[model samples]
Target chain A: MWKSVIYKEWLKTRWFLIIYAAIGVLAVGRIFLKVQHDFTFNEATNFWYVILFQGYQYFGILKFLPALGGLIIAVSQFFPETVNKRIKLTFHLPIVENKVMIIMMLFGACCLLLTFGVVSLFFYGLSIIYFPHEIIHGALVTMTPWFLAGLAIYFLAALIILEPVWKFRFLYALVAVAFIPSVFFDDTITGGYSPANPVLFVLVIIMSTALLFSGYRFRKGEM
Target chain B: MVRLSRYFLVIIAIIAFSVVIPKFYWMAFEKPVRSPFVMYSCVENDFMIQKSTQDGLVRTDTRGNNYTREQYEEKLPLMYMRQLMISGTMPDTINGVFMDAREINDERSTFRLRTRDLFTPDPGLYPMFESQSGRANLEMPDDYFRITWRMEFVDANTNKILEEKSRMFSAVLYNRGFDFPAKSINGIPTTRKSIDEGYLVIDSEDQLFHVKMIKGKPFVEKVEIPEGLKFKHISCVDFRNKRYYAYLFSEENDLYILTQDDYVLKKLPVDGLIPEEQEIKIYADYFHYNIISDGEGYMRSQILDADFNPVDEYSETWPVKMERTEGKIYKFLFPGELSLSNSNSNYNAFFLNLNKSINWLVLSLILIVIQFFIIKRRNEKFKNQIVDFTAILFTGIFGFLAVNIFPNKFFK
Candidate 1:
């Protein structure tokens, strides 16, 4: 059952994922090229000074890519099911209704995790070529919140789309939009998320469970 | 389970609303409010103020005498010493104290330390620069050190840990009674200046220590923090005068100057200064120094002679309109607020600050009664009304929005 569900989601989202990956690479590559150009055209040690002491964020160009990718994939995966009333057939399958919802959410999460992870790793690899460990480490920690926000928006967009009522969907959208500011709150501050990281992890867990509640209401036909 | 899920979703929605409504109100309605600038007049031994009024910009002394800009500058001779010197109007003596131009220029330097409530903690790593570089200009070092239970320097070029120098720094700190796993550490690594005063560290026991690299060696000193003095912020002051090592602010809003002398802490005479929200400016001359702190609704100034004696003090205040507006809204809408960040730390954590609750409680009661009538009109059971009422009581406006949006239905 999990295999079929995974395959079905893959078939729906493969093209979108590939396009997002290409865009992510291009965005990240542009930042790297800019840094290389700075090193070449400007004084050599100036790049080191900017990266180290100035708290420059080389990966800021890729900030919105992950969140955009997550939202697109979530909508693409679930909107068709709702439009054609195909979600009802899936709910009536040989399984507990909530498990099916949970499985679907997990599939979206895993794909997003892989997408965000690959992009972050590529950024890390590129950073170490010209920058030191501390610089790369600070940049990665600062970027983690943005990536987590991507996963959060994915689950939230899915919940809002699957929700059966307009008023309730608007409430979900309001809540989701309110959380958007927190993603970019400390993105400019180097290593700013060091203290709030534990709290952030907890927020991610809460967001994942929020989808279950939305799914429960849909299954029970609550207005 | 369905009911539980609804409650869960409602709670999340309320939290989100609590974060958004206040922000939206402020973004739309906030207006600029400026406090008067207060400066102490050394010659007159009185506080002077410059402020905007319905008439125009007014300059007045505390004794109620209005003065022109030139008169105000003449009253603060030492503060306006540079202007006077450049204009060839140098005073021979004022308030019985003669001033020398070169001496004033050489001795006069000011350093400011403002609090950043939402900054990153030290990553325990610092780039150790060579104090006496053989080259004329100081260059960035290739190695950085991390202080854990011990100090370990890693080569930035090769990324290899240097075990020997790491042991040397660890031993020196241990000899000065520095503990392992530091509670907080701060450093000044920008070597654009003439001298390097490496790092200020607070150990696990909250003891302060000064560590610097002198000629590629460790110079460790245990700073003497006053007994029972609880400080909340520390910053290194690399002034050309070299009079003070750093500026420390206590938890009780007292700003202390940590003099270069080993055991000296000069507490500045300023009152009710919120370091996080205030801007401090210090003007120094050979005869006197003027310290001005501007907070949200008020500005305070203190004048001190060369000996740090209080010559005069002055202040002016106006009502902060933003707080008043927020206060009015809190009465109508919310019982309290949930804050994600505080003045001391920028971490995303939950903190509940309650405003006056009686009005909000009354408002919530009225709202819930209206909701009860609506449910009753639909012939819903009394038990179903209980969830909606309790939610309103607990979450105020957010609960009202949630229940209206996700109303419970009963099929007759």
Candidate 2:
């Protein structure tokens, strides 16, 4: 049952993944050329250049890929399954709903993670060539917030489309409003840029949990 | 469920309280006031050999030429720059201002004081000057003076006085150096002579007055000495490959260099420039050469060309010290090959406007709102989505103009 659910999600989001991969490759190539054109041989090894390439600016483009992919996947596939009563057939086929939801969520999340991994790998290669001495350890730590924020936004888009209720629409608006404050208070709005405050980590967790629970509640009641 | 609602209410209350309390306190308590009392100080230098123990006294020059200490005590009633609308017994001293029996508490009690020079208000009074202005001015011996002060402060009860507590002050003025110019070379007699120019003057504490004097006539004056201060010797040298003339003043181990043309003074690193071999002190306006000085009795000097620019350098030793009093001190051991001006491109001004927090916040919020409305219209199956988008865009533009653009234009 889990396999079927995962397969269905994969089938729906495979095109998005391919398009994201293409965009990621092109962006990385453009960034490399831009970096090479701007800096001389010695200056290319500067710490600021490495940070700009591997950190905020690189993550900024990476974040959009997930948001766009998540929106397309949620609106076209996830919503239709509920609105068209296709979820009813799946629910009645002796498959536990939670397991099915988890499978579908994991499939979507994997695609996002894969796209992020590819982009990061490209950046890592550039960093290695240009700045061998600079440590890439901070990149992993920085990318976590972007991943979490992207996941939260994806969950929000999923809940908004799947439920499509007036009251739930208001709740969705509230979720977006909650994110507005994070743009000012947290660095994730600017492509997962951050100062590594623990409070921001708690905020992301709380927001993500709220979105996931809302999705679960909508699935349990409306569909 | 009851507890959950109570917790939610508490959270809302906290947010509301945080937002409202600051605004309330700002509106109720924060009021502007015009500060009273304008205090200033002046230092005079006398270079003549006649004076012995008198090293020239530092005088407190007030804004209104109100110099007498006893008169300042009597006019303490009018010292308060503001008169409040409400009546009460004015405090004797508020923020070190001796207030007389006058008080007021109206909203219009604030008045700013206009500060002016005592001697001559024309061309303005500088920290260092030679002689007094106008023909009938009080004239005396050769000396220079600089004065600085702590200005007046208005009392909370609307009374003001020029009170002396050495805290909460105005400005400080002090004399710097003497101006003397010469057009001829040393010992060689040409048609050139010395110019004795008098610039600023002040009264000394010893009831005697001093003026700044330059030796020789107008065009060939080489030596300049302040009248009252005892000096060991004066030396003049052509520096920076004869681009400018430097007048050196030496007293004991200290050396002061003043330019011949403008009389601008600068202190030289004499100890670092000379090794233990030479006990003589040397001062120059511009030290264009490099000096190698070991602690032992050995010294070497390499004079660079006048057109050579100094190299930029970064220092790791002796961390950059930021102090309010001492200002910035940059210690450089060696210069770098590349200058900062040559390597870095000036940051584009495009980001200058976008760097403000308020602009980005408003833009993001408007975008979020427009996105919300667009999605809402689609949910309602509305055919005319352009109207909603246009309305939101117009409102956002209007809000931006009102909040950011209008106020800046009006205030600035």
Candidate 3:
């Protein structure tokens, strides 16, 4: 049953995923190329000094892509189903209804993670080439919130689209926008998110479980 | 379950509006409110306030008497001694002390101290540099140390923990009677200057310690803090003068100078300060030290001899525009509005600052009445109407906006 759900999600998002992967590669590759150009053409010592002391952030361009991917994937997976009332068929399947919704959400979230992971690994290899391990670790830690925001928007987008009522959907989107952007409150180059990351990570995970409640409402035909 | 979802939505909306609406309002309307820089002039034995105004840059004494820019410079001869010397306008003497620009520049010391609110958390790690590397120039260390129960130096290059060096520093600090985990620590890297005076750390017991890495070894020394003096803030001073190590502020708002003697703490005779809320600037020369503490719209300055004895003092107040406007708006629109604010720190933890405004109540009443008419037109249940009214009454404009924008489906 889970395999079928995975196949359905893949069919929905496969083309978009290709574009997302290409954008991720291009963006990360561009940042590395720019840094390498600076090192080659500009003063290498000044470049390192700016990174170390002046808080030069190399991974800033990658911050919003994960969120965009999550949002698009969520729309692709559910917008068609809701438009044709095909979500009802998925909900009425032989498996537990909430279990199906959860599986679908997990599938979308996993895709987002895989996309972000590949981009991050590439970034890590590029970072160590120009900078030391400490800087690379700091850059990666700062990127955690951006990726978490991606996963959050995916669930939030799913929750919003699955609702049958316009009023409820608008309200859900409002709340989601407010909640999702708070993850980006600290956009500092180094150590901004370290203090609140653990607690915020937990809050985001708990907030994602709200998908089940929204799904339960859709299943009950509340609207 | 539908009712529960309604409540959840309302709660989320309230929290969202609490942060979002106020933030947008502030971004649109907020202005920077600043007090003028106040410096004590030992030559005139009065405070010279330098501020920029709509008319032009103004320099004034505490009595509202205006002075020209050159006169202001002449008044603070010690501060402007070098300029005065270069421009051939040197005053013969100030407070019976001979004015020499070279000596004044060499021996003059200035330090700044500031305190953050209690909610601001420290980064919990510090990078100690090699203070006495047996070379003329100071260098940055390759490792940074974290203090848990002990100091663990982690190599910045390889990201590996130096276990042996960690144990060695831990044993030395333990033997020096520093509590294992430091309650508070502040350090300034010596990379800015030729000479390096390492870090000053305050332990859990409120004791002070000087720690530095000297020639690939930990150099630890205990500084005797005055008994019963509860230190609240530490500002490490790395002045070229090298007369003092750092400035320490106590819980009672008293300022103390930690001298270069390594054991003696000089208690400066100045009072009536809130460190977190005030901007303090100390200007020192061979004969006199001028300490200026400026809070919002208020400036106080004191001149002291070399021994920290009060020589002269002055204070003044002025009308602050931005603060007054913010205060008035807050009173008029946000009465009884419970906002989840992370006021002092960057961390987004919820804290409440509750105040009642009759203006907010009136605005809320107006919004609720309009909402009541709409709900009546839609034939909403009495319970739903009451819920909307209460949300508006509590959150004022934000509730009105939220409910109108996202109408409750249960009403239909």
Q: Across residues B245-359, which tens digit of lDDT does each residue of candidate 1 receive?
A: 7777778878787788564778877666677777766766666667777776777777788778777766767776435766576667776766566554444455566755467
Candidate 3: where are CA atoms >4 Å away?
A1-7, A14-62, A82-85, A88-103, A106-144, A159-179, A186-189, A194-223, B116-125, B318-323, B335-348, B351-358
Assess every candidate by TM-score. 0.85, 0.36, 0.82
Q: Is the docking of candidate 3 incorrect, acceptable, medium or high quality?
A: incorrect
Q: Which ranges of candidate 2 are over 4 A from the true structure? A: A40-63, A132-144, A180-212, A219-223, B1-412
Better of 2 and 3 by lDDT: 3
Q: Summarize candidate 2's per-residue lDDT along B260-301 as a digit string, tens digits.
A: 455444444433332112323221112122222222222222
* Order of the predicted models by lDDT, top scorer first: 3, 1, 2
**Weakest ten-residue segment in model 1 chain B by summed lDDT:** B113-122
Q: Score each candidate by Cα lDDT.
A: 0.73, 0.35, 0.73
lDDT by residue (A1-223, candidate 1, tens digit) is 7678778888888888888888887888899899888877864455656666676777777777878987988997888777866787878878887777777878888888888878888888887787667777788777777787787788779888988888778877877787666433532467767666666666676667666666666666766
Provide a comma-separated list of chain B TM-scores, one per candidate: 0.83, 0.18, 0.89
Candidate 3 lDDT tens digits, B1-412: 4444445545555656766766676677777655777787777667788888887789998778899988899888778876777877887877677766677787688776543333443445456777777877765666667777898886654456789999999999999898968877776743776576777888888888988777778888998776877788878777666778888888888888888855578888888877777767888877788888877678788889877888988787876533478756866676443232344443334445555446678888988888888887878776856777898898887788666654665545
Q: Judged by DockQ cut-offs, is candidate 2 incorrect, acceptable, medium or high? A: incorrect
DockQ of each: 0.37, 0.01, 0.22
Error of 3 at B155 (Å): 2.8
